[model samples]
Target chain A: MLFVENRELVVPGRLLAEGDYFAGEGTFLEGGKIFSAVIGLAEIREKSISVISLQGRYIPRRGDRVIGIVTDTHPFGWILDLNSPYTGNLMVSELVGRKVDVFREDIGKFLRIGDAVLAEVREVDERWRVQLTASERGMGRIRGGRLVEISPAKVPRVIGRKGSMLKVLEETSGCRLEVGLNGRILIRGRDLKKVNAVVEAILLIEREAHLSGLTDRIKAKLEREG
Target chain B: MAEAKPEKLLVDGRRLDGRRPDELRPLRIKAGILKRADGSAYIELGKNKILAAVYGPKEMHPRHLQQADVAVLRCRYNMAPFSVEERKRPGPDRRSMEISKVIREALEPVLFLHLYPRAVIDVFIEILQADAGTRTAGITAASVALADAGVPMRDLVAGISVGKVDGTVVLDLMKEEDQWGEADMPVAVMPRRKCITLLQMDGNFTPQEFRQALDLAFKGVEQIYEAQKEALKEKYLPSLEEGR
Candidate 1:
């Protein structure tokens, strides 16, 4: 039996379900009952139950696309803060797709501190050491896009199902948005007003992440403001 | 040297504020009030106003403090200069320092700290008004802020003070009762599990009185736990109700 309806608001430790249900992310089971582990909207799919959290710091996972800020430099790579507990290491070789001699080559020419980067997580060790790669097309040091960060937990909502919300955001506002799993979003648009409107809509999704029918509301908002 | 005791703490079964013994002061709690902090809460308990904020589970600066197996939980309990009749000096006082340590320990038991090793979680509790039981109120508010931040925990910790005034046990002591009470004990408990995470005592209590005081504290904490859960839910549910 599910104690809460689908999309119902749930707080940490609120009983979610019982019996054969499998607990998923943001939920835990104990003593034959599944309970939420964060304040969010309860999501139920068949026998699996999870809660979509509204607020949380980003935790990096392997293969996640992230936008990061270069914060420091070491011998082989530049350390990037992924807006998360763990920082990602972007080796110069990985960024340029070539091997370079440390003594002969200057990595500073590749990436400097305060540079914003779009990279993919290559690997994560048990110690949470993350390695990043930017050699892929359209990945590397980002330039000339207004950056906006919402709560990382709300990133999926901004993307919507199958990129539906994102398509609507870009099409209505005439902006191209590059969203990072770590919550950093970059917007490029010819119209400044439209860019700011996209930022407003993203923040609205964060504030109302627990509510249902958000995609329609967002589309309505974008059209009304545009 | 001895201070004079008040003439009557309980008159016709009512305390000075017209609340019965074993009764808690009025409480109002709001979650996620601040914009910058990862999580924040504001609480008013019998005029003892407190605000709590949680940050991080991010990097722990000064590197040497990083724990290999668990995240470090840091708590700071500070009373504002204008909180009381007499101005409190700025900075961490001895009482505040001790309260900070115990509060950290109180919250550590429930957190899934191992999930974020090498990171640090900071809980800041600021007392804007002082009417006794500030530490307990701070703990209650801090736990709410932690939950608002989405920190996974076994359960929420609820806290209250129990004391003996006029040789009778009471729950949630006001400043006046604290000043004249025979004993003052602040306690924090994981209400669902009924496990004590914090217990500090001053003055006197016999074994029997201590047991009774714990009973009262547990009951008070249970009520506080409900309110804490409600505070988090209230932030999202009502707006959702209207949307539907």
Candidate 2:
């Protein structure tokens, strides 16, 4: 039995459901009962129950696209700060897509500290060591763009349902967006004003992600200002 | 102040504070009070004012302190120099150190620490004004702060100090009762499970009085549990309303 309506706010330990409910993010099951593990809105999708958390740091998972800042370099790879608890390790081979003799090539030529790169989380080991790969097209060092970061938990809302929000953002503003699951976004546009307007819209979304009719509001705002 | 104990602590079934044996002090809790903190809460219970802030699930510093399978939970309980009647020396004292350790233990069971290995979650509890029962109030606020930080936990912990004063079992002790009471017991409970995570005693209690005190503590904890949940909602409810 579901005890809460969809999008109803719940606090930790509040009983959410009972009997055959699959616990999703921000929720846990205990002895035939399901309870919320964080303060957020309870979401019920079919038979699965989850709470969309309003606040939290990003925890790296496989196949997630993230933006990372190169921080340190070692013999075989470089360490990238993923804006999370775990750092992402991108090998020289992973970035170059081929094995090269580290002794012969200066790895620093490809990427240096403070250079932001768009990459995919390839693997997260049992120890939470994150391995990143930027071999795909448009997934290398970021050269020029405006970077805006909000809470990682709100990233999904920015994307909206089935990329609808992202489409609205790009179509209306005439800008391109690369949204990282780790709460970092890159906006590139020929017109600086349109890009800044998109940035403002994104910030407004982050602040009001929990509200309904947000996508329409954002679309209207972008059409007006962009 | 070193004032002498009063001859009578209770008259007409009213303690010095004019509260009944089963009455609790006024408690107010606010969540997400600090702009910079990942999560923060301010709690005022009677004269006890405490602020708790939680930062992390971030990278743990000092490589050796990192846990292989679980995040390390660190707590610091500090009282402001002007918090008490006598000016307290700033920094960790023996009493505050002990309280910090106990508070960490009280909150540890509820957290899913294994979810974030090699990370550290720091809980800082500052006593801005204290009139006894500060440790219990601190625990109450710290739990809310942790939840506010979006840390996954099985439950929230609520705490209160109960004791025997003037040979009468009382719920929620004030400074005077704590100082002159026969037995003071601070108890923390995960109310959902009815499990005790922290239990400490100072002074003596008869078996009957201990059982009564424990019952009273649980009742007090239930009230605190409601307030904790209410505080968390209060922080987010405004946005929730505006969304509609």
Candidate 3:
């Protein structure tokens, strides 16, 4: 039995469904009933019931592309702050793409503290130890782009459905965007004016992500300002 | 100011505040009131104004304090120096410390702490103004703040204080009643399952009076739980409705 409609705003402990429903993220099952575990919009997809939370810190998951900042260096690896409660560790081999003897070479040559790197969450253990890899093309240390961070929960709105909002952002402003699920967006453009326009639009999106017609407003703003 | 106690707390079934024995104070709750905190709420029950903020599950500080298998829940219950009639000491005193511990325990059962291992969730409840029943109000506001923070929980907690004044069991005690009454019991409940989370009494109650007080507290909790849900919806639903 379904208790809440699709996309209905629900608070914690509101019953979402019952019987054969599989509980998904933001929901829990107890005594044959599925209930929302956070304040979010309930999503009923076929046999599964889940709630999409509107606010929260980003939790690292495998295969998520993220932007991390180097905060510490170790003999064999470096610790990268993922803008999350947990930090991601990038081994020297993962960044250099090959084994380099820690005793023979100073790993500091490849990366240093305060350097921003575009990396992928390669693995997250049961204990929440995150391992990141940056060896792939366009995945190493980020060099000349303006970074804007917003609430991680709003990253999906910036991406939009099937990357439509992203395409609008890029096409309207003429600025390339690298959006991290962790809420860090890197914008690069040859024209400073267009880059600033993109930054403003991103902030606007973050502020009004829950409103309708946001993508159109962003597009119109970028076209007028960029 | 020490004043003479009224000869009778109730006159013709009404208390000094012109309320019935079972009446509650006017309540107003607003969620997401603080912009900086991850989640926050401001609540006013009659003259008591309280603000509650939740700032985690973030990385726990002081490495040794991090629990290996679950996030640590910490609560701080503070009263502004001017919140009371007499100036309260600015910092955490013995009473506030005990309230803080009990508040944390009251809220811990609802949270899915194990989901955020090696982290800490901090709940800070500030009593901006006090009449009476601030601790129970704090628990009620803190639970809403936790939900506002998007912390996963099985249920939300609601609380109320019931007591006896003039040998009559009453619901939602006022400042005068709390100060001069024969018994005061603060009870917190997980309203969804009717589970009692925090129950404390600081005076005398007969066994029958205790049962009546418990029932009254549950009734108050039901009303508070509804208000809590409404507050959460009021903060997040307008945007959600427009988006759809």
List of clashing residue pairs for candidate 2? none
In model 2 chain B, the worst 10-residue window by lDDT is B235-244
Off by over 4 Å in 2: none
Q: Among these predicted structures, which one has the highest TM-score?
A: 2
Of candidate 2 chain A, the 10-residue stretch with the lowest lDDT total is: A77-86
The candidate, 1 or 2, that scores higher on DockQ is: 2
lDDT of 2 at B98: 98
> Model 2, A78-142: lDDT tens per residue?
99999888899999988989998999988889999999999999999998999999988899899
The DockQ value obtained for model 1 is 0.66
Candidate 1 stretches greater than 4 Å from native:
B1-4
Model 3, span A1-226: residue lDDT tens = 8999988899999999999889999999889899999998899999999998888888999999999999999999899988888889999999989999999999889999999999999999998999999999899899998999998988998999999999999999878999999999999999999999988888888877878799898999988896
Question: Using DockQ as the measure, which candidate wins?
Answer: 2
Flag clash pairs in model 1: none
